[model samples]
Target: MKRDPDFPLVRNLVITLFATNGHLIDMGNRLVRPAGLTTAWWQVMGALGYAPAPLTVAQIARNMGLTRQGVQRVVDLLAARGYVALEPNPHHQRARLVALTAHGRAALEAAEGAAAAVDQRIIERIGTERLATALAVLGEMRDLILEELAQSATPSNDPTLSIENEE
Candidate 1:
């Protein structure tokens, strides 16, 4: 079948995005390793740190755009390691609030300090203006992809509604 000219560009972008994601995750793992945290653990901790208050596993999942089950597993592990504590939620009977322990906060700060040097190196290589532009473009692309996903989830009457096949 004949493909649109833009297909190659989009395909390359998707491949590059995945490759970049893998590299970033690997870097994150290395940076957080000294703090006894994995990339996943750091991500959960970061979400909690950014939140105004302690959040439930489900809330963390939503904030991180991940699944509740996956977030819950990470929370359980963190809680076991004393990095976080689970307290009864007054609003929800079953959904307990997850809060970072003092140890967790300290570890997170250490990890951030360790990561700052690496981040500075990256910024110096890329330049602040270029990095800002890249960030904006990535944010826009993410929003567009999310909108497409939402549209795809809704039932439609047209059979040829798939964006992939659109001209």
Candidate 2:
């Protein structure tokens, strides 16, 4: 909490005030745009790509900290655009399942490769040690923030913002 010993209470408050979403939105946009996806679509693709089994919109929302309605919107868009296909949920007859299409899987694979390339380039430029250190710090900070948010009993904060936590 003591970011700087010399800085006083108001300075700490200023830092805490900056613990919001604007910079993250900008970062996510920059990271996803080169792969020809928005933050939302990329997140949906990633969720489907990585899940052990097909997920319902509600299930995806639970995992991704999204609202059911919000995830349903993404599912609808993905399905309409042929990025995901719906099947009957095995766990619930009344519920539907969402999974990636062949095209969607291909797109996600390519996007992941592109993202890796950019990550490597940044690491190379920054030097691996510095990059690793930064990653460690960011990962820890993200976990701490998410844990704090969840402790407040608001686990589902945003849909488009599901990150891996660098674990």
Candidate 3:
């Protein structure tokens, strides 16, 4: 079978993206550790901090591009640590809204402060123009992938694109 000419390039891009994500997470964990928070904890708290109001676990998961169960675990841990509070959701009875408490906000702020310094170092090393270009490329890639996902049908709808066949 003739391979699609772009397959190799796309595969390389995906491999690089995955590796980059792992590296970023490791760096994020280190940066947030001083605030007694892991990357996952900081991410959830940051989402809450930036939001106009409280959000449900599902909402947070969707926004973060994570699984609901994974986000739920993080929310539970945050609540147990007094970093967040779960309140009654007027919009949904079962799905309570999660909000950052004062403690959570402080921790998130500390994490951001730490990250700001690292961000500056990165900018110094990579330069603003190069970083901006990289950001634009990544944003475009993400948008295109999201569009493809939205339009995708089930595997049964396209056997040629099935997991087994793709592999």
TM-score of each: 0.81, 0.61, 0.81
After superposition, the stretches of candidate 1 with alpha carbons farther than 4 Å from their true spots are 1-4, 154-167
Candidate 2 vs candidate 3: the TM-score winner is 3
- lDDT per residue for candidate 3 within 1-167, as digits (tens), equals 98999889888989999999999899999999989999999999999999999999888986788877899899999999999999999877788999999999999999999999889999999999999999999889888877897689577685545643321
Assess candidate 1 and give its lDDT: 0.86
Please report how far candidate 2 places residue 22 from its true position, in Å.
4.7
Which residue pairs in candidate 3 collide?
none
The model with the greatest lDDT is 3
lDDT ranking, high to low: 3, 1, 2
Give me the overall lDDT of model 3.
0.89
**Tens-place lDDT digits, model 2, residues 1-167:** 64776668656645764763566456656776776666788887899899988888877886776777787897898888888999987667766889899988987887777578766777789998887896797667668777987676532764434542210
What tens digits encode model 1's per-residue C-alpha lDDT throughout 1-167?
99997899888988999999899889999999998999999999999887899998878886677877798899999999999999999977777899999999988888898799999998999999999998898889889987886677643654434553222
Where does model 3 exceed 4 Å of error? 1-7, 153-167
* Residue-level lDDT for 130 in candidate 2: 89
Screening candidate 2 with a backbone cut-off below 3 angstroms (N, C-alpha, C), the clashing residue pairs are none
